[model samples]
Target chain A: DVKVTQSSRYLVKRTGEKVFLECVQDMDHENMFWYRQDPGLGLRLIYFSYDVKMKEKGDIPEGYSVSREKKERFSLILESASTNQTSMYLCASSRPLAGAASSSNEKLFFGSGTQLSVL
Target chain B: AQKVTQAQTEISVVEKEDVTLDCVYGTRDTTYYLFWYKQPPSGELVFLIRRNSFDEQNEISGRYSWNFQKSTSSFNFTITASQVVDSAVYFCALRNTGGFKTIFGAGTRLFVKA
Candidate 1:
């Protein structure tokens, strides 16, 4: 079965501390995304990578960054965690490439989210 | 800019009752994709369905159904007999042609009570 795996299901960190959230996908998909979910606000995209070393900022990229060093792994990095940054973070991957078979790429497979609490 | 709207923030219904979630989207592009996703209390988004602009057919998968009306720019989801396990936050999403990213609507939280 196709799967996306998140390293931590729950994380608690102090304010001003650096944090890392890791994600890996076994499907060999070409596109990966990171999003933060808050009550009522839904899931807001933070960043996405189409290929290794290629990244693009999404709607709310502030206070967050991403790294895609390898095809299967995508990581989200917070330079300094703040109380407001506490939210459920989700990781997703799309098959093939971004533009190929637009219909096929439209569907995304997501990983179980990471709930981060900034103290 | 592409945008998706899920007007219902929360809905409560008794078990075995039918429920529908409304969704409207706006985009200048002629070709786009619409999707519905289910997020349970566990917080992971599960892809429910995907419909493209060229296909206007309403789809039914068992007790779950979707109405896609291109003229009105609406894609609504309905559950024939909702159960407690059906309780979840449903998100409507849009992806414009040639775009790699998707825009998600503010999810509708559904609570099914027995």
Candidate 2:
């Protein structure tokens, strides 16, 4: 079984506060991702990391950033939290499939998620 | 860029009834991957199935089955004799071979009534 641990299950922050959501995975997955889930909107990718210290912006990367200091840990940073930014945050990691194209086997193992509320 | 669209916003089914969730995707890459995920009220995503571009075979697992059509670019999920436990918001997703970008549909919320 793979475990993707999130730092907090629920968090409340004031508007304009900088927020950090941490994620760690026991599996040695080469790919890590951050997503924000909202009602009707589904899940939107915020950022992802394929290796330590490497990060790529997803579709909705505006006003958000990420850091992957260690292979097992990836962090999503909200530079200035706003009411619109409050949503359920998800973290996922996946081990690349051997003998195939890297993204061909994207069976993602996901964290429990962090529900952030910016008032 | 890859995009996924789940047209049905919500579906309600009585116990023992079968329901199908539709997913349509748009992508230029010939070798992309499609996926279905179930998000329960607990707010965690459960990976259901993954299909690559080359595999067009329909798959069945217990009461859950998936229909992947390359021509329509549609990956639909069906639940047979759905139970109350199967109620959740289902999402359709797409990821290309290049990685970095995994797009998701708006999701269809399912409610199974007993």
- Give the candidate number with the greatest TM-score: 2
A113 Cα displacement, candidate 2 (Å): 1.0
How do the predictions measure up, each by TM-score?
0.95, 0.96
Q: What is the DockQ of each candidate?
A: 0.62, 0.69
Tens digits of per-residue lDDT for model 1, A1-119: 88999999999999999999999999888889999988878788999998899999999999998999999999999999999999999999986544466433458889999999999
Most DockQ-accurate candidate: 2
iRMS per model, in Å, is: 2.2, 1.6
TM-score of chain A, cand. 2? 0.96
Clashing pairs in 1: none
Q: Candidate 1 overall Cα lDDT vs. reference?
A: 0.91
lDDT of 2 by residue, A11-92 (tens): 9999999999999999998899999998888889889888999998888999999999899999999999999998999999
lDDT, each prediction: 0.91, 0.91
